[model samples]
Target chain A: MKLREIKEILNAEVIVGEDKLDIEVKTAFGADLMSDVLAFAKAGSMLLTGLTNTQVVRIANVLDIAAIILVRGKKPPAEAIALAKDVHIPILTTKYILFETAGRLFAKGIVGCLEKVEAGSERI
Target chain B: MKLREVKDILEASVVVGEEKLDMEVSTAFGADLMSDVLAFAKAGSILLTGLTNAQIIKTAADRSIAAIIIVRGKEPSTEAIEMARELQIPILSTKYILFETAGILYSKGIVGCLKKVDGDFYK
Candidate 1:
């Protein structure tokens, strides 16, 4: 889905990257632990997170992740917004919780990124 | 630099992704805290970390990071290695600590990912 579609679905307010809303997103990952996001988020995927800190934008920039949707109606601080704007990372705010937001997106065909690893196959 | 060059420079042991030794790396980031690595690691860059866990490999896989080098001679568990191999993330080990490893890489022209944010013009 596109960032605009995601925004409409979530009823979100775009805090940055308005010009880049046309970007395409194939998958979505939601997590509060930055570590988990870094370990599992696929490139071009959208991140739905509640952790409103500067690190989130930094992580997004490094991974080339599409955008960030802050759940629970949380507004990130000035520092976070400024950093995000500088990097052109779209930051959105949503009133729904992470699980709810993810459910809605999944129902809309926005899939998650977990690959099915074989039960005991040890090869890469 | 290529992962082969990195292994040579760090005198690292390749635990996985040996077939990917030819991969190119443009940047390097060293951190033990997974959050810090997530926040700063550029894609296709090498990560020098002392923390050995499935989470480290997971983070590198998520960000498309090129490889992970465990510093301080730390060895990851079987699960971590298995996970990294599944993701095709090269895992290397070095006896040097994080600081020493970073210095060697920087001297060898490996740059970090800190951009210059303006001087408190805090907009």
Candidate 2:
């Protein structure tokens, strides 16, 4: 789905990168543990978390995530926003809880990050 | 520096885990691009970036970063907040631009992520 559609469905507010709302996002990941996110998240996936810290933004930069959704009515600080702006990432904030938000988005057909495993003969 | 102290300096708003504000952060990495943050950030370090997306949270989870700071006066979506809340990760935001923010924090002695090299040990 397009980043704009996810924003509209969740009734979220855009804090940065408003110009890139039309960006497409195919995969979604939900986690609060920065460690786990780094280990499992695919490159160019959507991140859903309540953790609002500068580390999170840095993590996104490493993984090449398409957008970030702050769930459960939480808002990041101005510093976080400024960093996100510099990176050209679109930040969205919504009021729905974590599970519900994930469920709603999943219901809309957003898939998890795809893992590419090696096979004996051919790539899967 | 302690997360709480960082919060105070940046005048940031904590999104969750108020009790963990006293957590110590020794290093900080600044970037707007998620790709670079993931490439160079050290484990248990603070992240400063402008990109806001679920992927950012996922990257932090993987790297085991101490905290996240969103610069330039931006906020994340509810989905993102809920995920961070579940992970017990503390989120903070500030109004300082990328360069200025890094400068202030650096002036306070917060260093960048550590650099580790991988090579033959006994060559």
Candidate 3:
């Protein structure tokens, strides 16, 4: 889905990057732990989590994730937002709890990263 | 600097979760482009960048970074903030441009990620 659609689906507030709401997103990964997101998320995935901190942005930058969805009505500090703005990563906020948000997005056809390895890969 | 000190140094505004400002930060990596941050940043480092998007948060989470610093006076969107809050990663902002921000921090003794191979490792 496009980021604009994600906003509508989750009833999220946009804090910055209003100019890029229409950016395309192909997949989603939901997790609060940074290590899990790094080890499991596929490239070009969108992250859904409840953790709010600067490290989250750094993780996204390293993993090449497409976007982040903040659940349970949390708001990042100004520094976090500024970092996201600097890196051109789009951030989203939703009032729904993490489970509810994930369910809603899942119902809308967003799939999570799978355990399957790619065609040319022999291991996960 | 500790996250609290970083906040004071940059004279930035805090949007939420004041409970974590004093977190310690040992190193920082600055970039606006997500691709570069991912390719070059060291593990356990803090990210400094100008891009405000969800992907930046995702990158940080993946890299095990301690914090993020927004340079050139940018603000992350609410969605971005929410994501960061969920991850418990501290973020900071400064009005200085990328070069100036990096220089100031470097002058204060923060070093970049260096290419070092371990002595015990085999090539």
Candidate 4:
């Protein structure tokens, strides 16, 4: 889906990347813990996080994430926004909590990056 | 540097993927915060974290990490180990604190995942 559609779907405000809302998003990863996002998020996937810090933008850049959606009405600090801008990463914000945001995205066919594990699959 | 060299450098014990220790690591990321790891770690780089959970392994697998080294003497849960083994991502353990471990590797020329910001370069 286009990031513009994501903004509409989540009622999100674009804090940055307003000019880049046409970016396509095939997958999304939502996590409060950046470690989980780093280890699990796919490159180019949109990151939905609640963490409001400069590290968020730094990691997103390292992971090559398309954009960041800060949930639960959390406003990122100026440093975070500056970093995002420096890296050309889009940042958005939403009033919905993490679970609600994830649920909405999942309901719309957006999914997390976890590799599917079929039941009774081979164990390592 | 080879993963084996990292093992030797840190005196880490291989909990899994001992055979894959020959893998080369050009960069490394050390963080307790998984967010930092995900945001900054380069693919195929070694992950040094103190967090011992299945999510760690899951995230590493998602990020295509070469391996995971649990720092500060933390033991990963059975589930975490099984996940890593299933994903074929090696798991190692070290007694060094995060800073000391990072310092040891940095001294050996292992660098972090952060992008270099040149000073006075039009920031």
TM-score of each: 0.48, 0.48, 0.48, 0.49
lDDT of 2 by residue, B13-97 (tens): 7876688998998777655456545655668988876556667877886889888887655576677678778776777877554
Q: What is each candidate's DockQ, to 2 decimals? A: 0.02, 0.02, 0.02, 0.02
Q: Any runs in candidate 3 off by more than 4 Å, and if so which?
A: A115-124, B1-123
Greater-TM-score candidate between 1 and 4: 4
Model 2 TM-score relative to the real fold: 0.48
Per-residue lDDT tens digits for candidate 3, residues A28-107, read: 76655576567667678788766678898889888888887876566888988999999988888876544346545666
- Tens digits of per-residue lDDT for model 2, A45-92: 888776788778888888898898876556789888889988877788
- Backbone clashes in candidate 3 total 59
Model 1, C-alpha of A73: deviation from truth (Å): 0.6
For all candidates in order, state the fraction of native interface contacts they contain.
0.00, 0.00, 0.00, 0.01
RMSD of each: 17.1, 18.5, 19.7, 16.3
Off by over 4 Å in 1: A115-124, B1-123
State how far residue B80 of model 1 sits from its true place (Å).
21
At residue B4, candidate 4 shows an lDDT of: 94
